[model samples]
Target: MFNKLDLSKELTGRRALVTGGTRGIGAAIAQRLLDAGAKVVVAARTRSDDTPAAATFVAGDVSTSEGVEAVATQALAALGGLDILVNNAGGGRAFLEGSWTIPDKAWHDSFALNLFAAIRLTNAVLPALRASKAAAVVNISSAAATMPFGPFAHYGAAKAALEYYSRTLAMELAPSGIRVNVVSPGVISTPGSDEFARTTPGFSTDDWTRNIPLGRLGATEDIAEVVALLVSGRGKFLTGANYRVDGGMTAR
Candidate 1:
């Protein structure tokens, strides 16, 4: 549950864009930024009831170059300029018998969604990002990148590339005062993950909890809170860093 009292004006006057912000973790992050006083544009292929009413919604996919351009254009037009960019549009295909059984298209689609989308969108919005006095880019990754789950090999590999890209981008943009960071989440409780758990064989939410030091799946709000802080002045000094919000799963 998100605490309404957690709102702050720390991001006042900032403009932000969150990809795949219609539902789940993306929705939570957009809402948190709005609550923190930032003008936000939420982009997705479709809008849902869960879409934050306070955010300007842009209907565009981020998985292709054209989609990335459309989304970046509309989001920039909506906000005038961008200060914070959250590349959160990402997901893996259904669980396969093994990585070898996964088709070539699945690998391409995985990289398109998890890696290329962020790369293209960042390139599209580079001008606006560079123009801001306090710019930040937060790329959402996954614990699978480090843990390397056999069933989600493509996803893990793409996220691993994204993390490396983010670090290198951070180094290149540091002198310009732009900050880039990665947030890698563990098994999180969301409608998408819930459905995946139910449909995938040999994957149990209970089993996941037993391995987590916190003894529970993470909430979307948990990821949202960290994102809000990272995009705000509170995380001004942080760049090229990966914050794993995994309840100590990676620590173990």
Candidate 2:
């Protein structure tokens, strides 16, 4: 069934960037894109203290304007031009607090990390993305954006903003041939997720798997494969769309 959509080698000669690429979904996407023949640059505030062999790492936080500038400068220097940009760098654990208990600073901080980071990075690299034939932006959103669990309201709100922003950018950039899209994933199993699993009350592995119609917690590859398709030529005509990798979570 999948053979008809081969799309193999569709990413050859392309240059890709994956923010928060040191681990989890970002790392998986970076590896897969490289396997498909795209040169990749992985960026985050810290290098994996563990994976020394991970993709060429560029150390820069996306929370500040200066950090954003550093990432953009390093990326352009490494790739000469940018083709596919995957904004995949972010995570938050504070969810039990009500909106009244949530500080204004925390809410704004979440937006900085989850929403504004992608916006600043995209803005800085617009020129390079504009210069490429396959220029595209892939914002990694969350199923929570729609689900909006009470504890993680701020995180969900930011992701929701990301989804809307990506859609808006798609229309504005469509005339310029720059495609912008979003990938909304359900919970995926990763090292970053392990702590969430252990700490988040009642969030057992079994619970997560059972909640999904597919009956399994997603592997990083599960999300990575879809991302590859979107950034590749196979998804050339796709823009302003949210491709959900959630295991029927949002569908429910």
State each model's C-alpha RMSD to the native: 2.9, 2.0
Record all residue pairs in model 1 with backbone atoms less than 3 Å apart, i.e. clashing: none
Report clash pairs, candidate 2. Answer: 95-151
Question: Over the stretch 1-252, how does candidate 1's per-residue lDDT look in tens digits?
Answer: 235433577789999999989999999999999999999999999999999999999988789898999999999999999999999999987556778888899999999999999999999999999999999999999999998667789999999999999999999999999999999999899999998878888878998899999999999999999999898877889999999999999997
Q: Looking at model 1, how many pairs of residues clash?
A: 0
- What does the lDDT come to for candidate 2? 0.86
For all candidates in order, the CA lDDT equals 0.93, 0.86
Q: Which residue ranges in model 1 land beyond 4 Å of their true spot?
A: 1-7
Q: Please give the range of 10 consecutive residues that has the lowest summed lDDT in model 1.
A: 1-10
Deviation in angstroms for 146 in model 2?
Answer: 0.2
* TM agreement with the true structure for every prediction: 0.96, 0.94
Q: Pick the candidate with the highest lDDT.
A: 1
